[model samples]
Target chain A: MQIVTNNPLVREKLQDHYAVDYAEGSFGELLVRVRDKAHLGYRLLSHPLSGSVKPNETPYKSVLISDGPGALDVESLTIIENSILTADKFPVKYPQMSAKMRADFQLIDYTLLQSAL
Target chain B: MKLELGYIDIQDIQFSEESKIANGVLYVNKDEIQKIVLGQEHIRSVEIDIARPGESVRITPVKDVIEPRVKVEGPGGIFPGVISKVGTVGSGKTHVLRGSAVVTTGQIVGFQEGIIDMAGPGADYTPFSKLNNLVLKMEPEEGLAQHEHEHALRMAGLKVATYLGELARNVQPDETQEFETYSIPEGMEKLKGLPRVAYVLMLQSQGLMHDTYVYGVDAKRSLPTIINPTEIMDGAILSGNCVSACDKNTTYHHLNNPVVMDLFDKHGKEINFVGVIITNENVYLADKERSSDWTAKLAEWLGLDGVIISQEGFGNPDTDLIMNCKKIESKNIPTVIITDEYAGRDGSSQSLADADALATAVVTGGNANELITLPKLDKVIGDVSYVERIAGGFNGNLKEDGSIVVELQAITGATNEMGFNRLSAR
Candidate 1:
């Protein structure tokens, strides 16, 4: 049942529905649609969840695929263990700067996805 | 065989007597400076006396002081990592000067920021390491003898300036394909950088040690911009240690010529600077006219800032004897006069003796060693003015007197040996 949800944060959010989703056996693909229009043109793409769900069963996933405009930071993940935390959390230490420049630093986007199993 | 990549780390540190909360991450090479990251923490503060080889990385809190900068020596490539302190108005930039006020050679001072200060007698801090020759201009003052000394001293300064100039060219990095204009601190992204140099010129009147201007250049690319580095003059180019005086060449044989004394102050110490003495021996003598005229013309061409003419002998003896003595004296150059006797061995003296009715005249400006005796228009081998062209195109002439009067301007391969000589001792 734990393998149904791949992301740690997504699994933690799905703890209440685990018993019900496991018995039903109904399944759907977890789909994340992104709308980006920063550049001259608009484009769209589907972000699949990390790792496989089960045979005929959908997997749960959350992916951060976009950042600030003209951003270079991008990554895709494949789930290995459902209950395990797969994302490495490196500390972000910032140096001192004037108060005005501090406002420019902000988290842009993230997502949480769960399929009906 | 594998090429070992050499590493250098520049610590962004400040030494301010007034503050504590230092800011900025001290950039260091991770491979060489493992001690800085031992705790997985960014280095906050530490005092370092000096860095050892391989373990040469240092980290300190960055404050308001100027950061360490880079300097290029001759042919040796770039010598990076130097810091200096900047002073506010009246905070005493002159106080940082090391050694005696009478410096014989140039000296470098490392301060807090990435700035290096160079001070000394006519110091020239250029990128090229191996300097071979130099040209120097002296300040103006009163008196003719002072002017002659100025000429001799200028020769001295030319030698000194050459040494520092060549250091940059000599020590360039092997990896560098062409000359670079910027300072290369470790870890910083390699881009075009700025070259640091210190140039000295003099202006009399506000005192000998008054402030002067310095120009920082890219050395690899453009010429320099002379900026006053003090509050007194701001960043103006035509400030202290420089002044306006007479034109390029004219033997102003008076007691108060401006170009005379300043030149002496510039180059009197180093090198074998020879002095040439000119005397007014013939106001009307037929025999001495030739030598006097040649000497006068030579002086005019050299254009020394100092010249002195006297109207009297040792102890206020005669008032009306000296011609244009006061004019030269007012200029504050050096002066001397031979009022006792009059004689001439050349036709040039006739023109000088007839310049004024005074018994004596003294003037100052450039000096040369080999006394030139311009033969009669028939005895002459070539036009003296053409000496410059003759030097490169044709072999010099053999004077009738058997002495090889080398055309001074034309002598080739005279390798600015004087340039290297100044740096050799330092």
Candidate 2:
């Protein structure tokens, strides 16, 4: 629902592809990797950090790295959003698709758009 | 008494008959009046004339006089009419008359200046049976000499008439068009001093002769070298001051630099035209290319109603698609194809070849200068189909450089819309 890359720099790299290769069984593991990863933190899409938790599928999802308070940082939220929309691969492996398919995928990817209008 | 004032040096010779040859006989047909007083004296009307050996002109007095003076004019001076009625010279008077005086039916009277004269009683009595005999012959023109100017004009008119007729027949309008005759009114006394103004007015008057009038002229002013009908909306008759009717290519040849429109604007009153056709060989070849490349080149080369491209050596694989593409590209410009292939299903070639062939033929065939010989067209394109319509319309000859130049009006009705549906259908 939310854009993964709200970073100011991402706009300049609009036509460039970004890879966040990960094996995530659930959304929590993906969030842990993002929180610990400084690179992902710098590029995360989120509002200022807060401790409030809303009821969801996993309310008490324990932080694996053992950080008790303020465990959810900016990076974790991006990983969370990325995990939910992982099925939608904007940049599919090139050789696997035909010219027509590539064009169709490009059409769907908003980042690939020259203009929203 | 009509006496010879003096001899007139022939300026030019013109044929009196549509055709220009005369043959016949002669005789002495003048009455001789003799008078004697006292001893012995004689006064009679005596004169000499030339005609066929056995035939002669009878004497008639325009006024009462002893003898009348006469002058003979033509290519040669007059020949002698028969004087002695008794001898082998006058054996067959009927044959001589038939040969000299009588013009057979459907024949034209052609006079030889050296063979006949109308002088004295002979001038009054001359019996030109050929001139008077309409059932057997047409009326003879005044004299029996052919002038180069007259020949050129006649030739030009005939050619233009013939071409216009063929074009009208091909277009097949609801009603036929006739070439209108254009003539400059006798001496505009007001414009006598104003040559330019007079010329302009004459042109406008000529153009106004019909709703659509086509005229051509040799580029000359006074004694025209060639001429054709000035207006072609009547019956293709020759009219106006045409100087280029039979000059062939140059008469219709277009040149670059100053455009023909400029020429027309300056002389619009004298020269009203919608478009022009350039018929010179070099000018034509300079504009030719394969069907596609040629039309544009030609439109620029010759300011024309439309450019026709003739693609030869088609019906081959390597060139088929290219020729097809060219034909399609030239959709707006009228084009022609001169080929030997029919491009039909039952033709010797396969269906794919047939299809390609049909496409090329349809796009290039109608209103073209076609030299292509088609075989089994009926089995291939079907009877009376669009292809057949195009094939039927193809009647032009191939140029030496392997292109065809045909009139745009020859192909389609005058609307911007292309004949795709008409040409593409079965």
TM-score of chain A of each: 0.23, 0.28
lDDT of 1: 0.20
Clashes per candidate, residues 3 or more apart or on different chains: 111, 35
Q: C-alpha displacement of B266 in model 2, angstroms?
A: 29
Query: For residues B1-426, could you state the per-residue lDDT of candidate 2 as single tens digits?
Result: 011112111111122323211221111211210111101111111222222222232211110000110112111111111111111110110100111211111101010000011222111112221121101111123342223222322232223222212212212122211222122232233223322211010010011000111233211111111111221111111222111111101111110101222323433244322222211011011111232243234343333233222222111211222333354335443323222222221233221222333244333222212122222211110111211112112223234442322222112111001111122221
TM-scores of the models, in the order given: 0.17, 0.17
Error of 1 at B161 (Å): 6.8
Which residue segments of model 1 deviate by more than 4 Å?
Answer: A1-117, B1-348, B351-354, B359-426
* Tens digit per residue, CA lDDT, model 2, A12-117: 3441443323242332343444444423333333211101111111111111111133434543354344332321211111223244333322222222111111
Docking class of 2: incorrect
